[model samples]
Target: MIDTADEFESACRILAAASGPVAVDVERASGFRYSARAYLVQVSRRDAGVFLFDPPAIGDMQALQRAIGDEEWVFHAASQDLPSLRELDLVPPRIFDTELSARLLGWPKVGLGAVVERTLGIVLKKEHSAADWSTRPMPQSWLEYAALDVEHLLDVRDLIADELAETGKLEWALEEFADELVRLPKPAPAEPWRKLNGLNKIRGRRNLAIARAFWLSRDALARELDAAPGRLVPDRSLVAAVVAQPRSKGELSSLKEFTGRQSRTQIDRWWQAFVDGRATEDLPAERVPSDALPPVRAWSGRRPEADERIKAAKPAVEAHAEFLSIPTENLLTPDHLRRVAWQPPEPLTEDAIGEALASHGARPWQIAQTAPIIRSAFVHAAQASDDTDESAS
Candidate 1:
């Protein structure tokens, strides 16, 4: 294990001399800190054994960056680690996400442990899953866990690459990797109040207005306390509080509805704000429209002919996916399948269908095999729907 800056630099020099790909894995301090930062990074090369780099000790990763920056770096679930890597100003030119690659290749389990076991015939221990990676002077077991992550990644990649080539799906994997490199992490928006479970049932504009105010107040307090919004004040408590409309601290306290930190820290302030806000508001309570909710469809209750078509198409799609060594979901999502079953687009020539499939990220080989069947099934569904509509009219 490489711990100090000098050792890390020396390892980078050795890795830089290699022409093949390098396996990369990162361990971050996620739960311990509000921001995700890499505490440790493990790398493995074809000739070189595993090496772990301590980000804090190294101070700067310029040498390590230069080594792996140009080569195709393989990672499992790259998105989670990409943000922390970007923070250090390290930009990789070529990237391959083994998880995405496995999913694309129809592997049921895409996790690193599972992939390693299945593809490389190695069973990785899971003792370090919940360990504190931020702790200094890393434990022996943790180091082993970290080492195992990248140790078999290169071998796994080789096996998957062969499968991709045999199935004529190598281009799909390349396209996915290219797409992965351009993605960046985005901050989640502050909309805690909007996620209330059943707030829509409360009658009137006034209820919604008060609920909105309460939600904003709760959010502000949560942020101030550095606590999760639900931890600060649950939606149920807020909804109940709004319904009761407590006029004072005593009334709010008497309700016995809230306990813990929210009651002790925020109830009095929240009640006062609600009372003060209500005095100026004159809007009547309004009922939220039921139609605004997402429509629920019963898959089994659909028209028999449509159901038959969908059922018939499933095995064919699965077979094609298996033959291509890619997941069936990657070819088309369930939602897309439903759309094709219920409402399909107009007929197109084979070439146009192939182009459309390719544009949607399907490999050339996949398009060549599945496009004709998909297009025909969709056209038939559309015509049938049109006929039914005309007859009803």
Candidate 2:
């Protein structure tokens, strides 16, 4: 509950004096704001005690960073928090994600709250789950909730780590964490905006071009305003606005869907941008071509047989998964099953099939359990298809 910068620095110093791994949690206003930045950071060390950092109050995070930089910190789901921590230039040398550890050890549910409760026999209060962390003069309840999140994280990590070691899955957990480190966020393609609601009805390429222009304009405005992008211009309104092709501010404002600040401040520039965008003639075609389906050769034409086999095998797979208290998808993907159902059975050896599964990231134990069923399905399909071809000849 300490709000002063000096108190925060002293707390961080106390944490740095700890001998073992630290546990961390972050509260961010992502959907509530234009920028997905951490508004609060909470950390707890083995001996020093729990600390909740108000990111706005302590603008510089150098002290906190230097303290935890070399320590083996444990986070429930590191990937989500790592990015936000990176934004603050606080990079930990080593990280163990408890959720990923649980998944690697074949836990049924890997959610933070679930893992923590299951591992430590403690229930977390979710009262502050949706609280806006960016607000100044933070509520006492929110501070308590934030502290509680990291308080038990070290205990959960120790329990999960011991479980992983006893189960001989420590290497597996390490591999999973290594894989997570490389999966840092990358920007995605922008074309999928066409499939957004109402935009699909705007048939021509010109209208789509106008929509793209307007969408980009709104994106920039949202960034500047530090508001959610949708608040600046909703997807449906953008579509409707473009479709109307309003040439003047009055006409733009007259559209039933356009209202509030968008109708006032946004109308003129948006209209101009759309009009300018429409003037350009070489916009890409709005509609995805009908001939875009993969070629017949690319499709495993044994889809019907594959479907039947998978449907028949699903119950057994589910039963096995339930018996083991794990998800069926973790054992074998539907694509793997379908591929096995449609392939030739020249390589009848289980080792060969196991190797194939390994290539697709299946664990050795998973391949060992599911290889027999997969091989049998392949043999059955191969025999059936061969008989049909022989009859035709």
- Winning model by TM-score: 2
* Positional deviation of residue 283's Cα in model 2 after best superposition, in angstroms: 1.0
Please give each candidate's TM-score.
0.71, 0.78
Which parts of model 1 have CA positions greater than 4 angstroms off?
A: 1-11, 17-19, 29-32, 54-60, 131-140, 184-326, 335-347, 350-370, 383-393
TM-score of 2: 0.78
Q: Best by lDDT, which number?
A: 2
Cα lDDT of model 2 by residue, 1-393, tens digit? 556789878987888788799999889976567887889999999889898887767788888988878888889888889888888988887789998777666777787778877987787878878776887778888898899889999888888889888977676567567656666575654564554567766877787788777777777787887877776667777787787878676888788887545646767777777776788776857555542333324455636555444544556666776665556775566555545444423466678877776665666667777877666655565577778889999
Clash pairs detected, candidate 1: 105-325, 106-327, 204-285, 204-286, 204-287, 205-285, 205-286
Q: Root-mean-square deviation of each candidate, in angstroms?
A: 5.4, 4.5
lDDT: worst 10-residue window of model 1: 287-296
lDDT of 2 at 4: 74
How many residue pairs clash in each candidate at the backbone level? 7, 0
Q: What are the lDDT figures for the candidates, one per model?
A: 0.72, 0.74
Q: Assess candidate 1 and give its TM-score to the true structure.
A: 0.71
After TM-score superposition, the amount by which residue 341's alpha carbon in candidate 1 deviates from its true location, in angstroms, is: 7.2
Report how far residue 126 has shifted in candidate 1, in Å: 1.3
